[model samples]
Target: MARLLYELCGIEDALRFSPFCWRIRYALAHKGLEAETRPWRFTEKEALAFARHDKVPVLVDGDEVVTDSYNIMRYLDHHYPEAPLLGEGMAETRARFFNHYAERTLAPAILRIIMKDLLCAIHPADRAYFRRNREKRLGCTLEAFHAPAQGLDQLNAALEPLRGQLKTSPFLDGQAPAGADYLLFGHFMWARCASNADLLAESDPVHDWHARMLDLHGGLGRNARRIRDVGAV
Candidate 1:
């Protein structure tokens, strides 16, 4: 049986916008594996009941079912040892640090920039649930976070370290792209597919790196559907 990957999508099935899901998508490509994409939506909890998980990025590989993007990456590396996601030597250790940085630093910053846009990108069936839960997490209404200039400024500031790193190396792991690169690029993919917010400036190293990333895996990301075209970089 062919492998299957269930990922979060918006109004269009092609608009797969989950940051975590995007990580695994690129990881799968890096490993030279092609899984059928199952476009899942925000209100599709019941659809995932078979996995006993309410989240997307669920992978079905033959008899094995995997939940969580990080775990799925580990699964791919473990099963397909030829193409590695985590780099060799001490690179895995360094990549772990970048992974943590993406989770602890970059994701939240990007969320602030695209929170409102995200809500609109989702299916009408999911709007109420999405707003209620996200608003609860922020302790304020979704509108408060929508296009906040301060939030965009914070996002640019948060990306400074990445810009500095890219200045010295082509990829996050120096010479080659690693798990860390995929992990962070997923967030940018989220912004790209869900919103038209100009999150990157032309001269920014991060922007250049993102362009290179989009070109990888045969333009898997660059060709994705953008639900809205409110702004451009």
Candidate 2:
């Protein structure tokens, strides 16, 4: 394949569950592009040295190398220019805002609720490294950082903005999904692949949007490999 995507995974090479990677995966499917996915783990930074970046979701399109989820999305849309991820005019600007919202607001909130669950889902080789680095960043041990009884209240509170938006339309981008929808979907996909806990109420509009995301592009996101308890439906 001329195009390849290196993604974060657990013990099983098929169990790719990186939120950033999921964004790229969804973007690729949205553009009707096919790229072979390569599984990478946290302890394997050396594997990505060729890209000069220490992260997963690295896109290798022949000689072109792109890192970071947002950048990768832009690269795909720029290079392909067929099925656009962000529409013209101010659409790109609006998508960028939602991308920032997902990375800054949504991701941190989801991490708090699933940090411990994520630890259990990583490769065994990555356990010590992940724990040490994350604990230092969080200023507490994983076990000590519980998000308070089910963490649903905190998660729901963080999702209020999305809930409100969903009530107005079927997706973040008025009539149909665009970059903003994929941006936020990545985090929910992360939780679905890494944890067993139900993060949304059945009646929540955000939950409904998630279901629609899962069903997009012939269920590309829905068919991904997840942990046993939270496997993709």
Candidate 3:
């Protein structure tokens, strides 16, 4: 029985841009674990029927099946406790807050900045599905949704809390990188892979933390295939 992870990819199989999936990718690396990743497109919901979920970041570990990024993180930490991700007590609670912050605050800001580029980066077959669903949810077309200038401002504002925290410590989770670090890092990876826009200024502490994150786990995020690498951007 092999460990398998189904993650979302773009036009090219190597161009994985989903922030949720990236969280699991970093989590697996942090645990010193490896799983064969299968590239899944937006329109390939049927492929995940076995997991009873229509989303990426679905992990199949031996006889166990886990859906959703946060659940997968907890599953990995429980199964492989050697390198714990979600710490005990308050630490774990804080990590969960980071997860929500990434999903609710950070992700939307980044999406607003990169929606157009992301649309172009996704597979042609998924374009219609992506645009339709996103427009309905956002109540605006992709073109109208893209506001890099405003988005960047919103992104920076949303990151102020993290920036203040990082000012005192090197990583989000104190001395070492933990689940909280990965939670936020995933959103930045989404922006990096999908668009060429510069979301962070060089002087920001969050930007410095992001650089350190990219170099983690043998440069997993840094070496990931970007849209530009596939000539999508």
Put down candidate 3 lDDT per residue, 1-233, tens digits, no spaces: 39999999888888899999999999999998889999999899899999999999999999999998999998888899888889778878878999899989998899889988888888899999998998999899889988888888889899889888998899988888989999989989998998888888898888889999999999999999897787524
RMSD of each candidate? 2.7, 2.5, 1.1
**Model 2 segments beyond 4 Å from truth?**
87-89, 148-150, 229-233
Estimate TM-scores for all models.
Answer: 0.92, 0.93, 0.97
Clashing pairs in 3: none
Model 1 bad stretches (over 4 Å):
87-93, 229-233
TM-score, prediction 3: 0.97
Model 3: lDDT of residue 152: 85
Which residue pairs show collisions in model 2?
none
The candidate that wins on lDDT is 3
